[model samples]
Target: MTAPDPWAGILDPGETVLWQGRPDTRPQWAMLSPQRLTLGVVFIVAAALWGWQSAGLASAGGAMALLPWLAVPLLAVGLFNLAGHVLWDAFRRRCTWYTLTNRRAFIATDIPFRGKRLKSYPINRETILSFDESEPASIGFAFEPVPMKRSTRMKMVGFERIADGQTVFALMRGVQGKIERDFPIDPESLPR
Candidate 1:
């Protein structure tokens, strides 16, 4: 008897599963650079000082008294910027699972409170595949633009920190090759 398909309705008909894995859950201390550390320290110190000064105004009535409470969120942000991000990153990696199929690459993350997310990036003939050849390498194929308050940053989405990177990369190349063979691009469509 054969095992039931884990991705029954998820994947399209005839889509073959190439690889499935999870990221290394080790603490990435290297993500906290000196600049980030300094910024975090500054934010923490400023928040603390503000909180202390505002505490004296606690005797005031109405919204004025609530000024002291504003520092709490700032302190939380500071803590997150400091070392919390490193721990959070590790935790997020632990919750994430990666799957590469003949058609697309999927990153499924299940975080508490935030719930589950399954994001897929297609691997077509035009898709640019890149490999970061490090210990427990990363294979990035797409750039997802993450929106911020003031600006947008491109986050590289891929199967990160996987032990078998080269093999997965080869499989992605095969997917692209198959796409090109199945649907060849017409030369007439080229822009002038």
Candidate 2:
């Protein structure tokens, strides 16, 4: 009796819909990962150390040797980490979207010159919720008992820099409440 849901196909057969929205198209690089910031810092430090060392070596090898063989690569690594990541983060924000259903939460992204990808996480009573109350808010999700290696681990998902963030987060909380009320764990089922 209403317009067809764009995300209806990805949902489960009996899943109830909660909320759906596209992330703002504004480019945002401030949300880039901590690892990216660390990488940039490491490169900058490397350039400083190598440049100082190469300067000392210049007296022995001459100015030509230092510039070509040493200083260039150091500068390149530093520039790549700083500028490259900002560009990547901006591109990702532009292509991201978010959806919430009673059964799960989903994020769909399509990077420029790269393909699209969709990831969904089932919502349960135990799923963690963290948020920022700034202008355009952010909600982040993380599941526990993770793998040791960060690269191999499941990264936390987020709805980034979107309007009405608090409203969306409240919807998530309501869905979680419904899950808990419908399927409360029984103490008798556990081994005593």
What clash count goes with each model? 0, 0
On lDDT, the leading prediction is 1
Instruction: List pairs with backbone clashes in candidate 1.
Output: none
Assess each prediction's global lDDT (C-alpha) against the native. Answer: 0.92, 0.75
Instruction: List the lowest-lDDT window of 10 residues for candidate 1.
Output: 55-64
Clashes of 1: 0
Please give, for residues 22-45, the per-residue lDDT of candidate 1 as tens digits.
Answer: 999999898988887888898899
